[model samples]
Target: MAGLELLSEQGFRLDGRRAGELRQLRARMGVFAQADGSAYLEQGNTKALAVVYGPHEVRGSRGKAGAAAGALVNCQYSLATFSTGERKRRPHGDRQGQELSLHLKQTFEAAILTQLYPRSQIDIYVQILQADGGNYCASVNAATLAVIDAGIPMRDYVCACSAGFIEDTPLADLNYVEETAGGPQLALALLPKSDQIALLEMNARLHEDHLERILQAASKACKDVHALLDQVVREHLQEVTALLGK
Candidate 1:
């Protein structure tokens, strides 16, 4: 909130974006031929790759294997050593990485129809190749695309975005600078089709009066993400169809 002006007099943010505007989003599915499903996505400067596998017998401890209830959703989130300006000694196993992994698991559990694969497991692995703000949101979006590419059953697409409050304006899709500005920021994931929220997290303190505006901004951004992901899925399908000579 101090070093750089988050919003200008003209209502533009540091990146020349409107308060509710999201950064450029681009994604592609089936990025890896060997994986059951894979996707690469870029949200502004944050880049992530997600790979999904399983719906097979659980790996590792049989005791931890899911019972007759539903498929066990396992998520692993990691950041590349060089992803941030300061390189990390290890990519994962840190407290932050573990926390992110749990968040991912919870988010997907709400969207995926895990009940379809009892006694099996579904694994989602996401790696951040670049460190920008909204890494969690980008990871959620990328993982959703990978899951779809895997042909997994899901109630609906899960889309996510981050929002921040600055100068009485709710900013959608925050960047690294905005995140580090010491303002209240929220990360939200939604099942757009059903208008259901999959995950919501907030950092810092925000006034109750501003919560609604921030939530609305984040919801709108998530819907926009859903549209882009849907288009990518359609294009991928068309390409596959053409390749099959259908």
Candidate 2:
């Protein structure tokens, strides 16, 4: 808000969208044959790939089951070494990547209804091919599609979006420039039909009054995302059906 110009005088955001508009979303499910499920999603220039594996036996440390009575959702969030402007040294295991992985696991666990597959693990791996803004949201959305592609049961689709509060206005679906400009950013993952927020995270200082507006913007963005993803899935199913007939 201070040094960044988020909205133009015409009320258009940096990407020339309205306050609640999301980036162009293109997604493909089952992109890989090797993985149980995989998907690729592009939100503007930000590209992400998600792969899901297992609902089978736990891979490591069987002792951690802890009588949980449900499957474990394991997530690993990694950015390609060349995903950013400057190359990163490692793909994963860094502090930020590790933390993101944990956040993703928690977020998906809320939506996945893991109790359906007891004593197993579901792995969601997200790779950021480009680092704009809203990487977390993009990853989560892609992972949701991948899980669905894998034919996994879930309570609902987990759609995510990022919002920035700048100059007393809420901007939806921030880019890297807006994100780096030091405004309060809120990332939300929601189930559209239920209108339940599975995950909500915020950074920087924001007035309590403004939080609702920012969250509203984010929720709207997530729903928009869900619509696009639904369209993609439906189209993909149609194509598959046609192919089977052929």
Candidate 3:
């Protein structure tokens, strides 16, 4: 942040996008035939894949406690070793993965209507295929589609986005370079229809006055993401309907 200027004088970012603009979003559902539901999504250079299984009978002590209340929503979030330039052992077997998994669980637990599937378990597994920032957002978005494809009912679509503050401007959908610029970064998951937030996390500190601005940017980005994902779902359904009619 000291030596590098994250924003250009021309009001552009390193990726050539303007502040408050989101990266290109592309997604596909029903990626894996074997799984109950599966989806793959890419936002800029970051890619994520998610699969859903169950709504079947609950198993293990981990799910037993929640069995009486509602369906057990178990999630696993993993970043592939190849996802980043510098390869590490990976997060699936480590603490970071566990934390991410918990975050995802919390995010979905708020949106999904789990009460209908009492004594059952729904497992969501999401993995990052590429990393260029916004990993958590992409994972949540992809998993949301996977659960939808699985025929799981939820209150509304959960869309996620990331934001950063730079040069007194709030930037939406930060990339790897912006993320490394040592500025305040925010990640948000929202339920668009209800205008409700499922999860919100921020790293670094920003002026109290600017916090609301960044949140607005992030919220707008999430709503934009919801539009994209909703289009994908509608297209997928149309294709499925055409095939069934033939």
lDDT of 1: 0.92
lDDT of 1 at 18: 93
The per-model lDDT (C-alpha) reads 0.92, 0.88, 0.93
Q: In candidate 1, what residue range of length 10 has the lowest lDDT sum?
A: 59-68
| Alpha-carbon lDDT of model 2 | 0.88
Looking at candidate 2, the ten consecutive residues that score lowest on lDDT are 59-68
Candidates arranged by TM-score, highest first: 3, 1, 2
lDDT of 1 by residue, 1-246 (tens): 446788999999888999988899999999999888999999999999999997778777772545458899999999998889996498358989999999999999998898888878899999999989999999999999999999998999999999999888899999999999877999999999888999999988888999999999999999999999999999999998999995
All candidates' TM-scores?
0.97, 0.95, 0.97
lDDT of 2 by residue, 94-211 (tens): 9889988988988888888778887788889999999898999999999999999888888988999999987788888888888888868989999999998888898888888988
User: By lDDT, who's the top model here?
Assistant: 3
Task: Mark the regions of model 3 whose C-alpha exceeds 4 Å error after superposition.
Answer: none
Mind giving the per-residue lDDT tens digits that candidate 3 earns over 1-246? Answer: 577777899998888899989999999999999999999999999999999998988988776877878999999999888899996686345887898899999999999999999889999999999999999999999999999999999999999999998888999999898998877999999999999999999888788999999999999999999999999999999999999999
